[model samples]
Target: MVLNYIWIGFFVIAFIIALIKVIIGGDTEIFTAIMNSTFDSSKTAFEISLGLTGVLALWLGIMKIGENSGLINALARFLSPVLCRLFPDIPKGHPVLGSIFMNMSAN
Candidate 1:
């Protein structure tokens, strides 16, 4: 019975309830508290992303090197048997498979 409509309905119901709480219930601080929490959450996410920038760059550089050296393609070939079983639709030796292997290693 669960559908996309139900997901949106939950948000809509919560929004209405929040509005009622702020207006009729005189819970004026709720909006301020929500805004403060939202800002704090975004700030924390930004800091984490910033901290990971160096690691992300290092992985991307390694992937680029592997691509240039054809190591990724070699790995893809080595893993082809398992990859073939996991992804039956992709043809053997497909360039996409090499890219997939690169992403897998980068992750």
Candidate 2:
């Protein structure tokens, strides 16, 4: 995932460089064309990011509601029995179990 982001960064940088080159090396028409293209691309990217952020926020809010409503706690309760059997040395209701459940629920 990190590498994917690095590649996307490289692509954006290359696009900006190309736009700069077009503005510098060409006439007024080329400059306008480049500017318009860049504006459109930026707007599209902004909209997509905004939509994704809204969706993510909604999901997080839903998850928070679930947490507060004890649904997540119920899930943890259901899993705790299996977890206890798997990790026999760990005490029931240990902090580790709670932390693990919290982390899993968050993801």
Candidate 3:
């Protein structure tokens, strides 16, 4: 919710600055530049994602293998004691403790 307001404020400020550039400073290409940048950024993002798809799939496959082989669970159990010490407020056998171990193992 706060992020939505931040994004709106960002675009509003950008529009005001671009309006001043076009109307007061006679910089007619301000809007064109902004449009070009937006399109270019999206295109670049898409290309990067496309290129990384294979790598992402490979890593996910590896994670699945670890999960199937019980390595992830083993790691979770191994780290549970340390996590318990670090997050003593969370009980040792709580679901969140397991989640914390799983999250750490994933990373």
Which one is best on lDDT?
A: 1
- lDDT (Cα atoms) of all candidates against the true structure: 0.87, 0.77, 0.82
Per-residue C-alpha lDDT of model 1 across residues 28-72, encoded as one tens digit per residue: 887777778869999999999998998889888978898999988
| 1-105: candidate 2 lDDT, tens digit per residue | 999999999768867777777688754365466678879999999999999999989888987887788776677677899878877898876657655676766
Clash numbers, per candidate: 0, 0, 0
Candidate 3's error at 99, in angstroms?
A: 5.3
Span of 10 residues, lowest total lDDT, candidate 2: 26-35
Candidate 3 on 30-106: residue-level lDDT in tens?
99999999899999999999989988898879878877787766776678788878987986656566557656755
Q: Predictions ranked by TM-score, top down?
A: 3, 1, 2
User: How large an RMSD does model 3 have?
Assistant: 3.1
Ranked candidates (lDDT, high to low): 1, 3, 2
Q: Candidate 3, after superposition: displacement of residue 8 in Å?
A: 2.0
Supply candidate 3's per-residue lDDT for 32. 95
Of the two candidates 1 and 3, the one with more favorable TM-score, higher being better, is 3
Model 2, residue 88: C-alpha shift (Å)? 9.8
Comparing 1 with 3 on lDDT, the higher-scoring candidate is 1
TM-score for candidate 1, residues paired by index: 0.59
Show model 2 residue runs off by greater than 4 Å. Answer: 1-28, 81-107
